[model samples]
Target: METFADLVRALDTNTKTNAKVAALADYFRSASDSDKVWTIAILSHRRPPRPVNTRLLRQWAAELAGIQPWLFEESYHIVGDLAETIALIVPPDPQNETPLGTLSDYLNAFADLKQQSEAQKKAYVFKHWPGMTYYQRFVFTKLFTGGFRIGISQKLMTRALSQATGIDEEILAYRLMGTWDPTSVSFKALVLEPQLEEQYSKPYPFYLAYPLEEAPEKLGPPSQWVMEHKWDGIRAQLIFRKKTLFIWSRGEELVTEQYPEFQVLADVLPEGTVLDGELLPFPGGRVGSFKDLQKRLGRKKVSRRLLDETPVILRAYDVLEWEGADLRNKPFHYRNQILNTLLEQLHDSGQRYPLDGSPALEIANWESAALERERSREKHSEGLMLKRKDAPYRVGRKKGDWWKWKVDPFTIDAVLTYAMRGHGRRTNLFTDYTFALWDENKSGERELVTFAKAYSGLTDAELRQIDAWIKKNTLERFGPVRSVTPHHVFEIAFEGIAFSKRHKSGVATRFPRILRWRKDKSPEEANSLSDLKLLIP
Candidate 1:
């Protein structure tokens, strides 16, 4: 536990990427194999379930520190993190202290907490708290809460592991994908000596594209690239291997049973076929809105009526594996040709397959591509995807090979109506805000109705200025949140908008952020609910 805590401190304090990788590599080289395995599991967001409730831990810590529960609560609110608050409030007992246990020992004991009584759990926590140092205690509490993070990406970790073990980073990335049991698999078998059969159901690390900032003409001639409409649906992989089928999301979640209509591919698609695609809700052979896809997603059991309403199709874009061989090393144009041919063959067999190749746009140059991007919203797509024809499928987020050029977001001028303290360093400042649109009451009176909440896209100076304004303009306090005088106006930009019965304003916006502080505008000049309704295409 102490060693792991040292690694966490080293990682948290470092701002340079190279320094972080070196620190992680040094730890990987020196730590025990079991500790290395557990560290990798934690960094990859595969930690064990939280052992005890945080409320109980807070109360117990208050008692141990001889402080009142209210004082602890206040400290927690001010600190913005429970783990850090408890670590600071409680002092270590030198006389009764024992050496801290290993990382694996701590996690194994926590995993057994489900069988233990509440008293037993309290005793276990009390037994360990006295021996640890401040940072160790913080890490311990964080692990117990299952919220231990130190800003390590899987790619960085893989690179560090490769440096430590003299193995290729890409191979390590592939081995780390999917739902591997951290407790059961040894580090040697999991990474160094991987078995191909065990990874039959595992997904490949998704290839992500950076947002294209400059004009498309900067990317050179149009003949060297292929353009495909960027669909606004779930990014998924359809894998059929060894007579078994699996659908894995980009987050590495196994969502096979969610859309069982695609399970028929197990028999139809040849063994060892894996296609990367976007899962879309295409009702009546026409692309449905993302809300229609959400209805299918929220269901654990796919009812007949739900299936009939939101029939899904896997719009395959790239082929990763074909005919029991990996084809990721091949050029994308070559792989795309194979993908199109296979889908054509499947369709010609007179079988209704829930698959289709993503169509490529015909363009003479960048100007034509930009014109096509303008029509993305009408086709229910996000924007355009530009892939180099000669590029091979790469792991994680790499630049140069692919780019996502999205359409301009829909914007609205809204009034800031509420504010709240944000987490981490912003805890002392009201950086989070709720924006509202003008709405008409049944009595024909105009009133403010909250339609969106945003906490990002402002400079630090702007945030501090708004924090001061929020403090001076607070009208009412509802726990952590403060109702502010609705005077400030902000232009909120969002990716998409949809009519939602759940929202009070009868609408919801996707990825809404403060585009700019509209100091020139007044609350009376803000956009109305009807204006937002006009945006819900």
Candidate 2:
């Protein structure tokens, strides 16, 4: 636990990627194999169900620390993190021995708390908190709360592990994908062992593209890039190997049973065939909006009505593996050609594969490509994906080879209606804001109706200024949130808009953020709800 805590502190303090990788590599080489496995599990968001809830932890902590509950709550708000708050309040015992528990040891013990009584849980926490130092307590509390997020990226972690174990990073990344119980799988078998049959079900690390901020001409000639519509749907991998089908999301979740519509592909696609594509709700021979796809997401079991209503098709863009051969090392154009040919052959053979090849747009040059990108929203696509024709499909995000040239976001002028304190470093500042559009009630009077909440896109200076204004202009307090006087107007930018019954404004906007402070406009000049509804495609 101490070693793991030190590693966490080191990772938090280091800003450079190489330094972080070096620190993690050292820990990977020195820590026990079991601890290393647990570290990987925690880093990859595979932590076990939280053994204790925040409310219970707060109560127990306040009682044990000899502080009033109000004081503890106030301290928690100031600290902005529950783990750090508890760590600070709890004093260490002088007579206690140093904790020698490994990361696995503590995690396993916490997992056992699921069956224990409340008194037993309190006794267990009380027994351990005093003995540990602040750093150990912080890590322990984070694991207990299941909020153990750090500054480590999966790529960096994989790189560090590769450095420590002398394994290929790409191979290590692929091995780390898919669901595996950390408690049951040893580090040797999980990372160091020879590839097992389980590799058949594992999905490769997804290749992500950086957003194209520059003009399309900056990427050179259109002939050098393969242009495909950037479909606003789930990026996924379809794998058929060893007579079984697996569908993995870009987040590495194995969602094989979620969408059984693609099960027929397993029977038709040759063994060991793998495809990288978008799982789009392509009903009525057209790609549906993201809202349509959301209807079937996260279902443990898909119903017949859902299958009929929001049918999905894997719009394959690239083939990673074909007939047991790894095709990722092949040039993308070659791989895409093979994929198109395979799909065409499958269709001509009367195999009803619910799959479609992503069609490349016919653009003569950069100007034509830019014109095509402008029509992305018309096709319900976010933008165009430009991939180098000769580039290999590399693991993780790499620049210069692939880029997503997205259409400009929908922008609207709106009024700030509410403010809330942010977490982490901005805990003292009202950095989060809820913007609203003008709406008319039955009485025919205009009122600012809350529409979207934005936490980013404001500079530090602007954030502090707004925080001060919010403090002076607060109308009412609703716990941590404050209803602020709607004197400020700002331009809100979003990716898409959809009519929603769940929201008070009868609308929801995707990825809303502050574009800029529209101080020149009055509150009454802000856009209205009716105008917002016009954006719903």
Which candidate leads the pack in TM-score?
A: 2
Those runs of model 1 whose alpha carbons end farther than 4 Å from true positions after fitting are 29-34, 68-70, 114-120, 163-168, 183-193, 198-210, 215-226, 236-263, 266-274, 283-285, 289-312, 320-337, 364-371, 387-402, 441-444
Q: Tell me the tens digit of each residue's lDDT in model 1 across 230-292.
A: 998999999998888988888665778889899878777888999999999999988888888
Error of 1 at 14 (Å): 3.2
What C-alpha lDDT, on a 0 to 100 scale, does residue 135 get in candidate 2? 90
Put down candidate 2 lDDT per residue, 285-311, tens digits, no spaces. Answer: 788888889998888889998888889
Candidate 2 overall lDDT versus native: 0.89
* Residue 336 shift from truth in candidate 2, angstroms: 4.2
Reference-based TM-score, model 1: 0.84
TM-score to true structure, per model: 0.84, 0.87
- Report the poorest 10 consecutive residues by lDDT, candidate 1: 194-203
